[model samples]
Target: MDMDVRRAAELARIELTADEAERFGGQLGKILEYIDKLNSLDVSGVDAMAHANAVYDVTRPDESRPGFGLEKALRNAPRKTADQFIVTKVVE
Candidate 1:
């Protein structure tokens, strides 16, 4: 299939030099040709999958642990409310 490199570049909002456009046009043509070849394949009974390999979460279970008390946690604050940090108002 003939590819219009200039039109494709314009549609993609990419500015390419004349030499670069010619180079990319050939590369894009080859990529499309490969896609066409893949489209010609058949796998009527194959199950759809996101990956060819098995995937699993390798994370540890979430477990709560003891932590610093509220007073200790806020000991270094320059300004404080009864149970919160006091900072300058941000919005006008």
Candidate 2:
């Protein structure tokens, strides 16, 4: 487990002191033990699911409505042509 900790730290480019290595090695060992315990469980009768509860889209339905005209939409523009706002060239 200590070796695993050292290898993982090396792969992650992390510098762990001896004390930190020992502490983390013990923690990792406990986590792996718990995983092993979970693997021993009998889950054959259980159904797989993406979520524990049913999920549904709760958004309001889309509805078209009257919109502000071009003049009102561009009322605050600092620069505008006859029919549209003029913006600085962004791509070229």
The digit string of per-residue lDDT tens for model 1 on 1-92 reads 56899998899899999999989899988888777886677978988899888998798668887798888889998899987889999999
Kindly give the stretch of ten consecutive residues in candidate 2 with the minimal lDDT sum: 1-10
Best by TM-score: 1
Q: Which stretches of model 2 miss by more than 4 angstroms?
A: 1-3, 41-92
- Note the clash tally of each candidate: 0, 0
Off by over 4 Å in 1: 42-92
Candidate 1 backbone collisions, by pair: none
Task: Assess each prediction's global lDDT (C-alpha) against the native.
Answer: 0.87, 0.87
